[model samples]
Target: MYKNIKVIAFDADDTLWVNETYFRDAEHQFAKLLSQYETENKIDQELFKKEIENLKLYGYGIKGFILSMIECALELSNYNINQKIISKILDIGKEMLEKPIELLPEIDDVLEGLQHRYKLIVATKGDLLDQERKLEKSNLLHYFHHIEVMSDKKPTDYLKLIQHLDINPSEFLMIGNSLKSDILPLLEIGASAIHVPFHTTWAHEKISEKEQEAADYRTVSNIKEVMGLF
Candidate 1:
């Protein structure tokens, strides 16, 4: 199936490592921290709304998320939030940044099995420095040809990546957890994708069923299945 595939771009967060789990944990902690001001449900909704509203300005990453949380806290508390709580919010982000890199099961095996035959690269959206730090710590850096820290993942962005790799759409394949970011965009650009879903997905990455209609791709329950595909 991959006879024509020259480059396989893997999504970094959630796809290669344990990422969304940390974000979920952070959000839960955040809601608890602000419990005095609002219900946990309300806090979660507002924080999500705030993050979406700030995405254009801040892009995607823990840094932007921290800012959104602070903004949400200030507004939710009518700017009456305790100064100590504000400091705690910053500490939350710092702790997230320092979280250890836990590679998803079989990620190394899949990469090792495929790297020799195809160009492997990380095509993902997030803070460049943080992603680099994660990759360096992952010890899987040596398997990839390069890493592309994208601002967003859309058809145009995938086209740009394919162009950069000097490969035709058919020669490129993307594998990731988010169907919205990884699968749909590749299909739209006439490329291929394989969905390897992580246990958790960020709300922003979810797609409606109507949006999934007629998209051609393969999905595997785990990353190990990838090794068998080739």
Candidate 2:
């Protein structure tokens, strides 16, 4: 099936290593800290709203998430949030940033099996520095031919990458956890995609079942299933 595929792109966050789990944990901590002012449900909703609002300016990654948490805390608390609580929020962000990379099962084996046979690259959206740091820490950097820290994952972005790599959409394959960011965009551009879902997903990345049904992509149980495709 992959006989024609020249470039195999992988997403770096939940697809490659632990990401949203930390974010989810942080959200819980944030809600607990602010629970005195509002219900946990309301705090979660407000934080999500703030995250969506800040997406344009902050994009995606730990730093933006931290800022949104701070803003949500202030707004939820009527700007009367305690300074110590703010410190704790920052600490949560720090811990997230410093968390070790927990690569998915058989990621190394899959990469090892394919690295010599195909052009492997990371096509992920996040803070460039943070992604690079994680890649370095994973000790898997040597397996990939390139790394792309995309501002957004739209058809146009994949088109640009295809052009840059001098490959046709039909010759490229994308694999990731988000249907919205990683799968649908590539499929729309005529590239093949594989959806390997992480257990947890961010609210914004969630897609309707109808959308998933309509998209032409393969779905797999884990990263190791990628090896079977070849």
* Cα deviation of 203, candidate 1, in Å: 0.7
lDDT of 1 by residue, 1-230 (tens): 78789999999999999888888889999999999999999999999999999999999999999999999999999999999999999999999999999988888889999999999999989999999999999998899998999999999998988888888999999999999999999998889999998888999999998877767789999989988887
Please report, in order, the local distance difference test score of every candidate based on alpha carbons.
0.93, 0.92
lDDT of 2 by residue, 105-137 (tens): 889899999999999999999899998999999
Per-model C-alpha RMSD: 0.8, 0.8
Candidate 1: residue 37 Cα off by (Å): 1.1
Candidate 2: residue 60 Cα off by (Å): 0.4
Worst 10 residues of 2 by lDDT: 211-220
Poorly placed runs, candidate 2 (over 4 Å)? none
